[model samples]
Target: MDLAGMERSSLVKYLVRQLEHFFPDGQHDLSFRIEKDLDQALARLEVCIDAVKIWRKGEFDYLHSSQYTIFLYFLSNTIWRSRQDKRLCTKLFYLNKALNGIDCFYEIEMPDIFFIGHSVGIVLAKADYANYLVLYQNSTVGKNHGIAPKLEEGVIMYPNTAIIGDCHVKARSVIAQGVSVINKDTMPNSYVFQSNSGALEFKPCSKNILGDIFRHV
Candidate 1:
């Protein structure tokens, strides 16, 4: 049902088709048994966040601590590699479409949210996400280490900004024009901008910042 360079041989595609079959009427019915599995995706996101919160507490027990460390790397790689994975993309595509029918994706049981610019240029390996998060063109969420980052509700990212590591970006946070965040927390009601200094700096998220962000996108 989708076009473009999408590969049918891709696993993401196969699942999407399979999922499409479940929606003969072209609508997602929450009561479908297959829908239960959707919870797994949300669980994965939560677990990733928990891992980061633990490390941030500075509890370095080596063996046990290493578990989350491995998971963190695996997640980062999964998000990136999945972009190359046709199967993953297929699943993501139909998943979004399937869930969209509900008119409230924020309450849905899903993860790995992506935008139209696509899964290819985007990577979100984040651990925590508030409802109503939106990602646009080429944005990435991975890590510099095992830092599990928290992205609050209504956060919108633009093209080519890689938000890496365990940073807490507060609610309604606006990541301004091509900025990257790593290993730090951003305050609520903030606007992030790329300074001439080559790093992302935060200021109160003013109407000016919001207007500029909407304008660029």
Candidate 2:
């Protein structure tokens, strides 16, 4: 994959510089440790980028805020899984949060292939997320009473929508904008809408909406 105008080494240096700028405690430099797992993280990110039809498959621009947000998440998650270094992971997590106004922690096991429409005001918890999950701005998938939602494949959470607590969001379910699905279940291949009386409503989806964003859904 092309790293915009940077080589792999240059990208590593750029990331290290950004981290150092954000966290300047002068304890230990992160160039060596971050570079160790960067290749694997980039490989994972490549798979995700390739699946999204809207993004160029072989190109990654660090200057792009949404792409960089996803990249930081992948890097932090990869390092956390590989080395289990809490300090380094925390810094990366904080960097991601500071740069992109999102609260996706490194411990949250996001899907292998997912798309972020806008990074701002997005908060994802430790939920069971499947592939082709598309999240928009101000969207949330959070836990309540220690129970998180289970989202199946081809699920799209529109802007200002939420799926919280004990909800089984079935496959190909599209949660409408500005709707909150709390402790509720959605039917497969349905559109979740809120009614006048604040009741949850489900309607069949006519087309494969995910096809517009994903290469194969």
Q: Provide the TM-score for each candidate, comma-separated.
A: 0.46, 0.98
Output the worst ten-in-a-row residue range by lDDT, candidate 2.
Answer: 27-36
RMSD in angstroms, all models? 15.6, 0.9
Those runs of model 1 whose alpha carbons end farther than 4 Å from true positions after fitting are: 1-120, 208-217
Instruction: Compose the digit string of candidate 1's lDDT tens values, residues 77-192.
Output: 34434343333333444444343321111222223321222233455553676644546556777757677677876576766676788688887677765788877777777777
Positional deviation of 32 in candidate 1, in angstroms?
11
What value of lDDT does candidate 2 attain over all alpha carbons? 0.92
Can you give the lDDT of residue 37 in candidate 1?
41
**Candidate 2 all-Cα RMSD:** 0.9
Model 2 Cα lDDT, one tens digit per residue, 109-213 = 999999999989999999999999999999999999999999999999999999999999999999999999999999999999999888899999998899999
Q: Any residue pairs clashing in model 2, and if so which?
A: none
